[model samples]
Target: MSDDQDQEQDQDRPAAPGPGELSPEMKRSNVRFALTLPLFFMIMFPLCYITALHLPVPHDLPVAVVGAGAAAFIASAAPALAGKFTLVPVDTPQQATDMIFQQTVKAAYVTAPPGQSAHMLVAGADGRVMTQLVPTVFAPFAAQAGNTVQTVDVAPLAPGDGNGIGLMFFMLIVCIVGFMTANILGNAAYFLPMRTRVAISAGVAVLTPIVLFLFMGAWLQILQGTVGQIVAVIALGAVTSFTVGLATTALVAFLGKWALFPGMLVFVFLNIPSSNSAYPAEIVPPFFGWLSEWHLGAGFVDAVRAVLYLDGAGLGGHLLVIGLWFLAAVLLVGAAAWRKRAAAAGEADAGDEDGEGDEAGPAGAAASGAGPERVLLGRVHDHHGTPLPGAVVTLVDHRGTQTGRTSTTDEGGFRIDDLPTGAYTLIEAAPGHEPAARATVVDHHGGGGHGGRVGDIRLVAHEEEHRHRAAVATDGTVPPSAGSYGGS
Candidate 1:
């Protein structure tokens, strides 16, 4: 009896998965997915949250910009012009008392006229980034104007600050902090209405950069630039992170996967290498520099240059690029989500309308064992009842497993088929349309094939969707970089 029973039990068991049996095509796909996945998220995720305004520039500090030279020096040293800056445009010595008064420049500067001997003004500020850039900005202008400009700082650097590397430290810190904070937000999500979620997101989005920049610069004494400037740069960092994080969410949803590795790949590879803050793109390989020109880091680099060097801004274009990227990501992701929601809603409205017209008991609907049956039929169309094409419908069951699928009407309605006759859920999706979902039953009484039911799934494309925003508004090619722009 025992042997016979064991043989019978063994025959009833399911076959096991094959060992090392992955096909060549499957292996290649897995390998490609492993490689391409990182590249996709790296570029797309961080792209959503970036913004130009959030860039940080250290604010609040004792800075003295004293110059005995032309006003061009002051202009070149605009970023480093510390509190109560004193600018002596003409080549005359400025009194210390006067500098203490109107705050004319952080310190005072008296420029020597053209053909005059070189003379340097002495002033000190806590930041070294500013120190390096002030000289660079003024040097070119002075040389062009036929004057010699010399700078001397009387104030000493802070204990935490490096000789000339503090700004780089701040930039690195800002990026690191922003990236982590963004990750935290990406994790804490819930099922709130779309509009409410957007509002909440905007608030969080606004605060992330402001707080991070202020906390880091103030705590670390990251830069000696004015408090306002530091705050600006920090803001830039935060905006960049938020946009990136949101885009990351969209991608994860589309891939129907966890957000971790894809997000990490984005933060690590493309974001870090192309930062261009660690090393100027100019000195790096062609690829590094080229990448720098496009990434948020490029704006960050230019921003740091503005806050530290005080001369090489290019803020308008750099910030514009970052802002535009975020704008585009928001629209793209928002549109996709909207479409999914609208389709689901369409099915729900059909059910409600049908209920009022012809009463049907739940018991009767349930009696057919809810077998692959369609107890309901509906149609989706424009307000004028014209059937639309190319709409995608996703069918979900009680357990949330998708069971049915179809496209839009040739005339203007929809039919959902091949399901148990019981209650089920439907989700519809279309680009540029708000998403809609609902629960319903199928026509399964006639068996699997015959059970298919037609229900119109109607959706209207958003008015805004009629025209997409321009990624490149200008018809012209970008003026060639640095050299071609006519200034080095």
Candidate 2:
């Protein structure tokens, strides 16, 4: 390096920073960012209303009615069902479903030629849910009439779809969400200050999946689906994690760590329960029913349920919601990163101005301005020097804009950034390990405060066997054979 360049660099700074080291001005400019908080309600309300709330049952939905008695006799109950569901009544035995290919009726019920037991002919072309509806609705009528409704499938489901396609589709999306969250959080922990963002990100990261997973399983027993549903939840965990990670990073890029709360409320509290996976939202409480609008879980679940149950009548709206979220998040995150670069350049320019002024000699300038606040950021690792992945990091100030936040780190380390000079409760995320949030006092007021350095902030990932045991004891069982983070 030339002496001239070296002198110019030293002249610009009160102190020289080592390679990869961050300066106060640099932190101030790059650390803070802002962007649009999606108008979730506005985006999803219309679709939720049209398909979920509105849509009258499609009419003459080719329902094959197979039973005994005459035209009015077998159909004594048809008028009642038709009042609600548009049912196509196939009159005779042989001619009942001759036009099945004509798409006239979806199912056919043929009386067993006078003395023969009644038989059913169902079209295999329809969705699993739509196909099942025929049998489910017809059984009660046969029971009331003292006649058995014997069903014969003219068509059956494809083997691959035995578990139902919609269920698998939802599982795939959940997997996408999980990986997306992991990568997003990992990026923030790397780009921002590692120490603070780690625990907070990890905290929100892990809990988000756990919360969504447990709800879909415990609150709604949709987890008990056929062979297909058995491990479907595991995939959902992946989806939930990745999708949340994307939102988290996008939010953090713009809003910083506080983005975790809104992310969860957007994906979890709003999406999962109201998804109407177990029952139609009409059956659930009205307030809780709107989950389909604001929550991704609910939105995907609705889309999957439609593909599986609604015969594809209502998928358009929910698909639109997911598409918008993913696209918008990608753009916002890109913009936020761009802004950081711009801000960093601005700070660098400000430093150059200072050097020029100093060389020109001190003018009789008496004006005073506060210098940038120093932010403390560091990585948290175990004593073993391994990345304490999935750790939570938190940051708060006196005003409490950060009143509630808990985030987790990705497979790397932790970071906490954008903090003004203040005392902070720096917490780490260890599921069962309850480590008190260590405290730190930043000193950006360099000339008047302690020293040039911001402050000392260090944390170690705690190993708590007792807590793990307690968690198992309280739950009366251990986690699956999967690793601690709920995996195989």
Candidate 3:
């Protein structure tokens, strides 16, 4: 047979495996991924729950003290109750009542003159645990003055939500639904553009909260608030859902299938424990208390409590936290979309330079095995020579346009294949480090299968760079230039 005929026959045969056939590496990766969930749940559930929930010790719980001699009583009691309670002395019972309604104090202790029982004003809306804990802690203190404590629920929970924790559970439900919807969209409808995905997420956020509100409020009667307050709570829920959905979707787009780990880590592990839902932040460990200050779940729960029970006191601060998270999520999704577009544009521009057009595609002649593959290989490392995995390497052409990009693997290795032979500037960047750049040339006659190795590229930490510059400035000497490189 003629050589041309033989070549044509060989080309007719499939060069790659069938669509249903999974590579051995892919199979192993899938198995490992499936096994990771139970392990993650086991570790995170205990770590987050136990550390935050188990043996909660209230630290500096604010309790307003009212009536005459309140200041003197607190002064005497302050030493023994050093870390447990912060006694805020108020002139009258009205001030203490106002503080409880405003959520400035968890509860208030009103001392009677002598024989009459002292009243303990507690907000059931602060959760059943706080209501019970306040009286228990203060009863002995009241007894020392020859007076018994009488507990009063100044701001009680809704009749249907006897425990007062239903709002927090509601917030958790909304958040889970929000993020899960993003997961579905990421996996099932990934072809949708970023704008479309965001719109769909927004729609889900708005609708899901309304549906949940109907079930948790209208039907169940668990929620208690005016029409405006109810609307505000619903808005907070929508914001929570929208922010979480967008953030999770962005993570999926950026991290691919492995996004679940970080997604759960942020939304579930850190968020739920720090939410101050089951227990207030003052009662929990300090780590969770810190998280509660800014976490999404905490913001949602706090906002709901303010709207429903606290007469909107401190609502703005809680909303601000949620707003910041929303802004961050929007920025993340925008950045991911921009990166995707830039990558596609780079590939298209590279294809145009190769004169490949649509038919030849991004792979160009290399796809048809018509020419040797022009590839670049490199490893990224820290100044200490430790491999910097997940570092991004970008190749820019002479025209200052990005042509290729790839991330370093577990071993800090990266490869950009099927490139056109040309001069390029390779930039390696990792978080917390200053980006390193070097010039290199890829040629048809390059080493090993027409590809070139850029070797090890090291990045210095930003602090090190700053310190070096400062030291040079202090010495009255010019800082050394960032190193230069020539074509390989």
| TM-score, per-candidate, Cα-based | 0.41, 0.37, 0.70
Error at 99, model 1, angstroms: 27
Whose TM-score is greatest here? 3
**Candidates 1 and 2: which is better by lDDT?**
1
TM-score of 1: 0.41
Which one wins on lDDT?
Answer: 3
> For residues 1-488, what per-residue lDDT tens digits would candidate 1 score against the true structure?
45456446435643211222332434564587688777776665445223211232322322233344445656665555443233444333445323422222333334556765343333332244444544554465456556776666544444445554454454444444444443443333322223444455555656665665555456766454566665676667667655665565454333322444555554544554455453434333445447767766555655655544443235566677678757865875586466535533443344344323221122222222212223234444543335455667677777878777876554433455434444456666566554555443343221111122333343434652221110101001110001000111
Model 2 C-alpha lDDT per residue in residues 67-131, reported as the tens digit of each score: 44546444576677664444444556555555543334556755444334555566443445445
Question: How well does candidate 2 match the true structure, expressed as C-alpha RMSD?
Answer: 19.3
Ranking by lDDT: 3, 1, 2
Candidates 1 and 3 compared: the better one by lDDT is 3
| Model 1 backbone overlap count | 90
